[model samples]
Target: MAIEKKTIRLLILEDSQNEAERLVSLFRNAGQATRVHRLTGIDDLNEALQHSWDLLICAPSSEALDPTEAIAAIRRQAKDIPAIQLLANNDSDDITAALSLGAQDALPQGEDERLVLVAKRELANLEERRGRRASEVALREAEKRCQLLLESSVDAITYVHDGMHIYANRAYLELFAYEDADELEGMPMIDLIGASDQASFKDFLKNYQGHDGHAELQCNGVKANGHSFAAQMSFSPATYDGEPCTQVVIRAHSGNAELEEKLREISSQDLVTGLFNRNHFLGLMDAAAERAVNAGQPATLAYIRADHYASLLAEVGLAGIDILLTDLANLLRSHFPGEAQLARFGDDVFTVLLPGLSPEDCREQLGSLLKKVESNLFDVNGRTVQSTLSIGVAGLNEKTAKAQEVVNRAHRCADELSEGNGLKLFDPADELAAAANRGSIVAMIQQALENNSFHLMFQPIISLRGDNFEHYEALLRLHNPQGEEITPLELFTAAKGAGLAEKIDRWVILNSIKLLADHRSKGHETRLFVHLSSASLQDQTLLPWLSVALKAARLPSDSLVFQFSEPDAIAYLKQAKAITQGLNELHCKTALTQFGCALNPFNTLKHLHLDFIKIDSSFSQDLGNPENQEALKTLLTSLHSQAKLTIVPFVESASVLATLWQAGVNYIQGYYLQGPSQSMDYDFASGED
Candidate 1:
């Protein structure tokens, strides 16, 4: 079970590069050569795992990554890649718990002697597991399925064991003129043969032994009532009930009579693309996955989806896109060379496998291919339809070792990076670095939320009321290392891209609670709102984090309003509904942000009894424009008539306030009141309103 290699590619997700380097040296000295990449943040982890690696060494206990979180990320990306947690203790209980947390082994970080031994043993186990997965591929095809195709044909078939009739299919019994199945089962092999053919049949049985592949013999069979009939019988060696047996196919006439039926029985390939259809493709994908594991090679499939293909189909018609798919398929076959097993995955997506390749090979080739594919374009009916291939590549490579997770990760990356016509590859390591930074940002954002670098600035909410002190909204901000101030939009966008979205949302919620506490303590408690992110829409439990934060601050949910952006709010409406219902139970105020812009969740406000609708600033930008102004006025009147809802119009300029107020907008927010501050905790320049 020895790993066959010079050394395994390993990575250390340690914030300390020195510690990572020391382990790298130890692995090299211990007969394992490797290139170790060090991860200090969650963002760059994706880059690290876009390929395969032998192992990942992590120290969540040393504040590098929380062991559980890191393990989840590892399983998501490199499922088969083993992870070893460097524990501070050699205690058995700690080791057992680490194993349960998905760590392959827990070894003391500064140890000598057995460290190399432990690494070797884990590597061997990894290889063995990979081998077992490989060998079982052929047997996974359903036995009943094979029997169904063989027995259901309208042809004579009799199974012979040691020259005695073991069984006969219904077609075989019918052709023999046997009264029933039992009459066919117990009869001697010679009984079915014509009396004149006994000697020749014996020769046929003897010659067919140990022979493989196709052969047929012309013969005569004795039917019931002593009738003789001419027939052709085909013999093949096959396994039945764990014993060797001979398959006999006898027809009333020549074998040519059954040739057309045989062709129908072998139906599999997809007709349109001339590739394996769905059932066959899935079986092959499974086989390829097992083969990769068995052969100890990295495996991945590319979900090459044709972006904007639907619109192209609409414009150019089906015949054009059909030729386009055909041309694209030919391009894939040529470009991938001899590496991948290609298949049409239905719709505009096609799948291919690069099986039994090393993790390094798998990664290098996919990366090189992505760059090359950037310039490749497709032509539809002589029209160059500027179409791009947005691919989601998933595999048994380090970042995508499992079947389902690989698919999910690839889809997520493709969807997020669709702005570019070129391929955008993803590795979880990229997300891990950003996630790691979120823990630090959470602490910093909470403390300085109301201070100079972080304070709540008032933006005027102008509507029918002129510059009313009664209404203003709060925003969050951050300061970069370069002494440049960053808004919540910038900070949150990076976090969302890096998958630190949930953590950032948590930080905003907890800090917002603290802001409410400050306002209540100063006897200036007013409704200050914080916007919820689309990513946070999935986190139903984050609402409970606020309950604890509010209790800690000795404030009620009534002092705060939870604002949901229309897009995020509408995307996962069920999660949003559950969240809203929970907040409604707490008597907390709820409002929809960018209300007019959200097409889907815009409907939620009418049915869910939503409290307020923030007129999206797009209406403000186009207030003077005739088309936009009419749309905004119509929307304001309709929402007011149906719900008489409080409308907080987000105006970006003092110039637009008078026009917006005359347009029937109630509350307005603009630079006239002041811009958003860095803090969620402090209300800056109270007299500005």
Candidate 2:
């Protein structure tokens, strides 16, 4: 619904400009907004046919243009426009000839009312043909994507029609101990399950209609070798090879102690710095708050933030930042003794809980630690990078009943402090003001949504290799009442807090698809990478809604790549996997953005099949360092080995280009290429090697 009404692009084959204007005016009189392009000769007609048009109107009696030749030319190009021929006189022979030449309808010239009616009819017919073609293309693409996903997925997957295996992926064939897909071509669905659960599965399948489909069961799976293993099988309704079928996904269940330990570590520890994650840190803060209220114990929480963190990231990259944080965490661990907790509280910010410490003592300890951090030159890939930290202290007392309140206060004070000050104590007034400011932002987002005031910006994703296609990442921008653009971070935070993230995502998807479709109609092979929020990933209706949107826009499924952050995909692994699978089934591509930072990044990839892996921007910061460059090369090699394309972002310098190119990266993007712009005008061909 983003594009409430469609504008018809009409191509007119007429020697006289005045005649073309007159025809266009008739459509306008009928309440249509027509964009008309008049062709004076065959050369112009041939060039114009490359662009998309809703309808083609030709004056048959023009001296320079022959109606039969024009219709034949349009047909030869295979352009799906409803061609209407205008005859100066109603000669039955001429009319029949025009129809034979592929004209949809022939009308007499100067019959204004009849011409308008015929034009509207032809335009409606054009829309219908386009819609039908789009749906057919989408269905075919969906089947292709499904095949690719199944082949690449680590889990065993197969499609069953009438309880017989019609298709199986490599993983399924290998899992069943079969050498190839042909070995399991006609296997019954019940043969893979244990005898005990066979009857129950049959009963379940008898009532399955895809509407009540998604179900998982634990059962013993029998391999081709007759060995049985405990497996978890999930069933979902799917269509494969243009036939109705059920898709079965199986994963071996293991009770390995090491895997459990790794899972626990991932849940509690930050993958980069090996410190407590944000959730675990908040839990510690809550316990500290309870102790302060119940036992009357004094505690202080210090929020440490890297000053100008964005600039530092651009300078050193994620690997460099990781090294800096690891060294800083070591210093904090040594400086603070037992009963003190340290956490990497998300994105260049660290938190420390000091129990049994007075407010003045907490400030004194934190100030000394800050000085130590500032004075030390951290070794980031053999390059000494000097950085400063800003600290904010908030004391827990009997009056502080909630831990989040204390955390918010500390963050507010940290934001208020200047870089020169480097430290600040939490002020109650600042907390109140911050709350009021957040409330205002939430209201602004709601108003903007109501007014349909959000817009999209694009940044080019340049290919390191010679890829002729133009690719861009679509970014959302919102305008406030003052008509100034609000940053995406602020806008998303407000939308999430207000429980409107899903709505915002839907808006972005619809508008981006419409815009991409229109752009492609202009003869550009453009692809858009649209980011989705966690809410959209978890929404059950998103896939079906996306199908309708794509069909209406007539855009190819592969043209729009849906992306989400690595952390979101990991945190909501089940939902993310389901969404990704569904997207694959719909023939759309998927990308995991801000990747390579998780403790076990590849572990998530093993469960969900993806087409593109966007290396976290952190990796781009220190590519100048040979050590960092080697690390990046190794990561890209691993990903390439898995048949996954790699995209590295934040390429700000020419020096880094050689490193990324030599690393065998598939795509690279940064301000050096171009920043986000309102238009998709990046000269991809000019940058081609």
Candidate 3:
């Protein structure tokens, strides 16, 4: 069956009535059902603008109604109507003027095919603009309703931005003894805290910044009457008036712990199924994630969706579906009792959180529930409706970053069920396998190498030994057609598979040298650490080519440090040794990066006498571990003994400075000093002083 499209509404303003009729006929002949109205004068256009319109066509000026007056009339009425002008002849100036006067396009007379094609495009664009306007209106209405709900809510709520209250609900105002919201507006939230609690509140606020999830603090709140009362404030991330802010809900502290628990339970329960609501279930997930990531505990989340929900809803109405959900919730409650949180996550999906359970154990338990649900018949208002489930299980461990990720993974697993009534576990390997196929990345790199469109980013490597020399690590970046940056790891890996690694290396070297030469011309003595791939290490032709390029750029060879990773050097040790010797012959410095990962780290250094040895980032990341710190110190000592200027990468904070300085490391680099940018503007003189 072919679907029918809506009629295109057009408004035409022409000096001759015959031309308007012909225009309508042309549209009809082009297979478009158009309902058009003819405008004779300004009054006619004003009246026509009151109704919906798609496209407007106007004829050349004849002292009656020209294209200018017709388009101006449409604009004055603020109508989303696209206007096209018909010129007497194909004069370029006339077409340009018509377009400048707000016409979508100006077609010369007698071009019926071109006019029809342009009209179709204008009609499509008009429909899209109208749809967007409708959506904006609907969004405004929804925001209004939400504002009304917030004002009438019993919970005391206030939105705070940078510690000042931007908005407060009626309950929030009353809780603080303010007569009106205006009295509380623009007031510092810390002023509401008692003098003794302000310091602790400030500390809590500092820790809560940029963190998700919710936090609660028990403190004393000062009322307008100069009385202090115990208040429990809950903070969560929220947005107000399209600006990100923190939402604080304050409740009076009650000593009746049991009663408080009962109130919390009532608020968190769903009316239809008596299970935990979506918001409360998400809160439990957050707590579970905190335990898993911080305490090394294991947990599992299951997203169970009732299969064929639309068909089931059709079979048993809304009331019957409620009954079915209640029955299913009860069955789920029986299976997951203690320490297991069950929630009505959505209309047809139920979530189960199994804490302290391995993925294997959770799968076994869910498998039994799947069988029970399949065998049992759900009685919906005396009508039996048997349905199955699609369950997705995701494990949460020390590797889990947040709770939402687990929920999303679990939901994705459930959605993978083609025939319904099955269980699947989320596997990290699947994501890795998908990411490994990067044809788009290879294409982007190839295009960049061909067009010389790759961008070079520089991060300053500051010296800790009081050396004032400016050093930057040259990084390569490739943005896809969509302008999204592809990471260096993914970019190079793809380029290598496509045999473009050596080309990319040469491109970086040439560009970096050019940039360095220009920068040095400005009287800044700067050096760049340019990286090379494994393919470049084996390419014996690279050294000779690099010499000619450096000489052409009039840049000193010592200004560039050609760096290759330890893994690459280990894989091609003989090539790396030869490359190191060749770079030395060219008077260019050499650095072996990501060092100390091999079984015999010093053995590779024995063959390749390098200028700089950048220790592996693992040593820096694990500095908190005492053994790792000792390992780094030991590695640095051995390198220093070999006259190798040791540099520790990933110096992410000032806290690691004292350790690195005491360890006698020569230089440091990471975001703490500077991130990769297009400019080499780091102040080496000030830092050295």
Candidate 4:
């Protein structure tokens, strides 16, 4: 089957981040961008399963998780995510075990072509199953609506199976002068006709059984009161409650315009919140996008999510949650008034589209609304539940080409918020820049590499204690012809896509070594932590090349600490373990940035030897929250227990300094001390707190 979707939402149960990327790259290379989340344990798996996922690829069993348990979790959630086990070494026993654990297929880890093949097949099959389920649900809903219309309909209608009355509407009962439908349910169609017309009615029924279209006959009808009346009866093939039957309508003059109108109204409305549904709202979004792009109109789309929704679910049962959502919806309706399209995106999530409004205007409106929601106490089941909102706003301006893309950007902004009761406005410039420069980015990168124009900046990783250690993390930067800076994220993403990541990594490493050696010559035992791309982790010759470069610069290998993201190390666990081992042999230090992001971060540590571990910047960024502060303290204790020096980055204020000191963090880096600079001039000996 051909893969039609441009994006695939994937969940990987692999502990290694490099391996996960390998799977993701397969989809990317096949023109399918992926939104992937790697699961490290059952908890991570369970949390990720809350969202819709296309595929699950996991190791048969790892120290962090079991594939069987992951499958069980998916089942427990009643989600239709397809699971496939990626086997190590392709052992027959492992294959048998993985299949027995309910994996769709067990395949070797390195068979890239075959893996894509099976994944596509499974994705296609999953789509078919979801489609079938949706159709089934639609059929059931349609049946209920039709039954409702039949009951309220003015025309006298009855259903007959095998010449015996199976069902009769209220109109039919009243037309036959019966008090209730049960009195006519078991009665035969022939019994309802007068004796004078029974023969003709029997003939009409017999002929209509062979006929596919409707047939009508003028007949005398006998009521339950034994009174006869001239009536026109129409017969047509129909199904009632899954059984084949013939519908008989008497004097059917009125049509079903009212029922159709009711169906249309409900189809566009959400039953829970009484707001416009997702499908209808998306149509409005598309129209807004078109207006923004073609008619020069500007609109703002806001994605609002109720914070701590899972906790709220625990506080209120499903029915109560619905009531709370409805209350929230009503508040939104009142706040927006008219012309603003409000929709229930999903459970506890709402979307508001403000037409003819700039993002700034929208932000102001949302800010006011945010305060109202935060202060207002919602009543659910006679209990008060106060919840905050996280709103992400994006402008549907001339640059907005796709409504879905705008939705994704707004959602991403909301998800990126560290705290609740906050609003984030998505900057469209970065997205526009990336797209506008995609064609020239590779050329710019090549020019930078050939001309040796790439430059590095340093940010001091200061010690929380009064130690005289000068440490900085090296940051890479690039400038285009317009003198605009391109972030390392954008550069590396383009480089990897263009297959220049390895060359770029080598360039950064060589330049970093030279700069560190020069900085140390000034009688400063300065140490620099340089980031390496995932490509460099897989480069078997990187260690040997680094050894030559360090010797050439006459710099001690330990002074130039090499750092890669935790995700990179996890994705290429085997290579990371080997590279770290090789670096250790060369007396070099290695550190993992974005550490503690994995489900079992320590599980990756078990495979490699590293001297320094930098906690993910989010931990430092969200230190204001007590739970985050405690989590950071606990993580620091664990790292210290392992004899590993922990570095906390993104320390932007004095407020977190006391916590870091109490947590015993070795080093801290952020704007609070000093921002990145061309020179390593941070006065570490100043003794400033």
Candidate 5:
């Protein structure tokens, strides 16, 4: 396949028939026996270059065989052909100057030493051109072969020139809907494409002639049935009928008709769920992001993993998963309107893009939407099964600027949030936030071990009658060197978002137990309560870790209350229930801190045996908002029969306290009791308890 430099040939064009004949004889006169082709015109010269002529030696001619025209023609047919035009007798300097114009040889058209040397030198240049052209041709042929092997090609292939179709492949006729190869002849190549795509196709063609721009590209091509599929094509300007033209190759991905489609995507689709294969869906998400950027929009990526999909999948394998995906996909399509791109990412994770929507708006909607999805049981293989979901949403925000950056964040958040299907929305702002730098936050927690930035303050849980404090809830704070103490509100929430919840929660628990014991040792008895993040349950070591922390503080299990929110409780309901039940066995108490969430099942109360349920602020706000008061009273009374329920009315004013007394909430815990008092100085907010 590799042609040697010695085997190179040259096309010679000359106006002087005798001189051209003599030039051919001189080339043959070479002791090396090199090949020299004698042509009279540009057409004949160009035609000879296609089959490996290394050089084009042109001489003055009368008609189409003129050497000047021959050089241009050779350049067009094969731009890499080394060409040298010949001139007449060397008349002092005029003859040599004439040779300088186009000829590589001079000397009165006689075969001599100078002519032989010139011929040999030009042939060497021709070899270099041949190597360059061969490389380009090989690359084109390889790409064409790849096109032929594509199971899902969209390009049509044709070998023709001068508005005539010399040959058309099956894909070529079928893609353009031409009845036969002859049908495509005498027609412009643009006619196969739609009016809109024609101009773009032509522009692509024009660019291809000058540059290597004809790679993979998509356009629309008309079909015989008057329908069309997006055609992805590539072109290479090559030879046909010894003339200048481009050989185009194209493929049609799928047809417009659903039944006649190339890929049976529905089979690959998980019916009950509507996610694609693990491999397929991730690729789809990446592709969707690419499309989103092209369309000038901020792409939102979400990974939804069902907590109990494995049990469902195991119970009913392929058949069941299919029904699940199909149903889920249909539901998603219905909920999201106007061409929302959906990719069934994996078994439990179905990715989607709501492009152009702000992260805040999307977060609120996904928060509500996922709740609806988790509120019911899905029917699978004649068995009704329930599963909660942990959905993580990530989007192109200020910090998460790129598509992959946002996607990786979203996936990582999903992993953090997947508390047996519990949803986690990861914020890039959590770590590198405006209030705290990442280095300092981590360093502060580490340094807290020695300097005691970790300290607990108790907010008195006053009784309804205001007779005495029922107990004190342990709250945490961090004191920076500036003397401004940061409350748990500042760092705790942010830490939980950054996967530091386990360490912080454990630290708080140990410190709280120690503080409670110390207070009791000073003859001040107070029950200790520590808050836990949803992330903590996923930590396999949390229970054993808690047991050790409890023993070290010499605190009775019953004196410790583990506080958790209703949404968090419901999200990892199975795990939450198990932990709560275990705590009960150890005689420890558990309270739902923010109970009665908008979407949580009050029915969950009947299922979970609890020590206490703190009605959410929404239901206890303004205690006598009548609707709220009555709702709280009914919920409390219902719980009173089942368990000891504490209706903690968060009041900040006298009116709220009076309303709570009338509403009959059992306990009050809020700023109205006393602000989170500083340990160094009890310069709390101006309030009377």
Candidate 6:
């Protein structure tokens, strides 16, 4: 592979234009491309220091520019450009003085070949310093993310160094009956083990080199209250806080099936609504299907979708949505048998499996339930809100071979309902066609990934306040084998089903970084906003991977802002918070997109320290309405009061711009400005205030 040549921006603190040209020629003659700016005095040097530069070459003997004064100016600006001082005479005292004054090196003048070599070496050193800084930032981000994971893990985890406990997660503290981690810190690891096991544990520790990395041992655990429990302890060698340590994971063998079952429920169930999650629900469906087959019984699945859920969510906020879902779950529980399986499926969908309900009975029951939900006035923060449901019923029979097929058919029927409030029964023909379509989409996604056929487009996030910095949001596009574009919604749905969302997120991040780096190389100070999926939010390795990619591209961390949708961030709040905090720690900004849709969306802002909030497009869509304008104004005011930069997207008309400007939005993006294009060619300066 051939290495691409890089252009270095050089600031020359030389009074003589001729000598500056001579220096530039020397670099060029040595096969180095340079953009040279000559600074004749302190003012010129100060102005030049405002922008980024690869290296600074100072002529110490210049009458107008003093090398020491120039170096001090650069220091005052906090610029990190490597500076080399050219001495007219090769004097030890002068070289020492220059070196002490923050000059990286001093070179004797009149030696062109030596000048080129020293300049090149200094530039290389500058690049190395930048790389190291990026690595340090990445390391800190990784460590922070790891700490978060450890703290949140359900398994009792502890880091031991020299037989002393250095760190312990919440589960570990609870396991040992300690009230706080502070109580366990610096405590002896053996204190938590029974006296009978202490001797064997010590022997095991003495002989353990962690060469195998992971090993489990059965031991007796003693709690703070002197109660002992059987425990299985797994040990692995790990690094924490830059030191070698042993990671101990303790799984208590309480021998209580109920406790194990409860733990499983906590992991697989939704906390707020207490409904089975998508995965857990599907698992239950599979088991129910198997039992139905064994008993030769009939089973029917109902897929319930909330009508106009986006509008409801906007009205209620996340807290209100939670209350709505909980109420809905309770309603389902009351209407159905106790043994009926209910789950919170997708964002606005719910699923119920009735093991013995016939198609007619299932439809009647669900229809009545829908009527009750539609008639009920939900009190959301003193406001009465009504919601309706779309029901799809799929009855299991000899032909229903797979649980997923039934579930998918029910979902499809619910989605295709002409009247949102009515119910539809699944058709076998529709199921077969839908399955084929899904398979085709999955194949397209796989081929796109393997063949590197995905396309990236950038939409300019123009500053309403006339900020000089350029910003663009990176958008991804996928195509089928036939060359027709596949919408992101379709592609992502397929990717998520195939468990490839993380891979897609990684691809976008890497490509966006490469594009941003290339754009920056052309003398533009541009920033790219990249979207991250929920998989990336939970992925502890993403930060480290991103750091390496940024360093490889030689891009500053600040030049990339990672964005997460408000719904996704809420769905995976813990992981989102951790990832955002990690990104901020790495000096990268984060934006919550599709914001202001959730009822009480500000609640999320209180928990997350974000740099930007992209208002949901619904707000923009309703801008023409006076009431919506007021709402937008109010939302923008609240966001600005909290010191958040606001970005309003989907600005399709000039009429909306006036309202947005009046609302004091910090940034705006939509087709009206420019749709996502193959190039970042927006004239941001033209729209400056």
Best-performing candidate as measured by lDDT: 3
lDDT of 6 by residue, 1-689 (tens): 00113678988878778678767755543334578888878888877777899888888667888778888888888889888998989999999989999998897876654566677678778888899999999999998998899888989999999999999999998988999988888989999999999999999898886455688899899999999999989999998888999999999987987998899779898787798889998898887777667766778999999898899888889999888888888888888888798889988888998887767777778878888998888876677888888999888765567899788788888989866988898765564444445657766666667667789999999998877689999999976645678877567756765778899899899888888888999999898999988788889999988878888888999999999987677667888889989999889999998887554689888778699999987778767789989988999999999999999989888988888888999999999999999999998877773
Ordered by lDDT, highest first, the candidates read: 3, 4, 6, 2, 1, 5
Q: Which residue pairs in model 6 clash with each other?
A: 316-599, 317-598, 317-599, 317-600
Regarding lDDT, does 1 or 5 come out ahead?
A: 1
Candidate 5 C-alpha lDDT tens digits along 239-328: 554466666677665556566452557655554454455556556556656665565556677776666777778877878777766766
TM-scores of the candidates in the order shown: 0.35, 0.41, 0.42, 0.42, 0.36, 0.39
| Model 4 quality (TM-score) | 0.42
Clashes (candidate 1) = 23
lDDT of 3: 0.85
Better of 2 and 4 by lDDT: 4
Q: Could you give candidate 4's per-residue lDDT for residues 1-689 as a string of tens digits? A: 11443367889877777667767765654445678998878778777777788998886457788778888778777788888888767789988877776788989876665777799899989989989999999999999999999999988999999899999999988988999877877888899888988887788778788889888888788888898877878889999889989998997323465885788789999999989999999999999999999999999999999999999999898898899999999999999959999999988789999999988987778999999999999989899999899999888989888999989989988987878889999875545445446647767788778779888888998877665558988888898768888865557767776788889888888888888888888899888888877788888999888888888999987897888877677667899999999999999899988887665789889999999999987688667799989999999999999999999888788998888998899888889889989989988877463
**Which structure among the candidates has the greatest TM-score?**
4
lDDT-wise, the better of 4 and 6 is 4
Model 1 C-alpha lDDT per residue in residues 49-154, reported as the tens digit of each score: 6777777788746465566676778778756878888888888888898899898888887663355557777777888877877755545555666678767988
True-structure lDDT of candidate 2: 0.82
- Candidate achieving higher TM-score, 1 or 4: 4
Two-way TM-score contest, 3 vs 5, winner: 3
Report the C-alpha lDDT of model 3 over 1-689, residue by residue, as the tens digit. 00014567778777678677767755543334578888777777777777887788877764567668788877887777888898889999988998998898998876765776677677667778878989999989999998999999998999999999999999988888999888878899999999999999999999999689899999999999988889989999999999999999999877787999999889999989999999999999998999998999899999999999999999899988999999999999888868798999999999998889877787778899989999998888788789899999999999889899899889888988979999999876544333434436766766677678899898999898876468999989987766788876567656766788889898999888889999999998888999988789889899889989998999999999989887677667899999999999999999998787655789889899699999878789857778878998999999999999989888889988888898899999999887888889888887777
- Best of the two (4, 5) by TM-score: 4
Off by over 4 Å in 3: 1-6, 13-50, 61-64, 88-96, 104-128, 206-216, 237-244, 256-258, 269-689
RMSD versus native structure for model 6 = 24.1
TM-score of candidate 5 against the unseen true structure? 0.36
Give the lowest summed-lDDT range of ten residues in model 6: 1-10
Per residue, candidate 2 scores C-alpha lDDT tens digits across 48-167 of 888888888888667777877878888898888888888989999988988988999897877655666677677767778879999999988887887788789988998898989999
How many angstroms is residue 147 displaced in model 6 relative to the true structure, after the best TM-score fit?
2.7
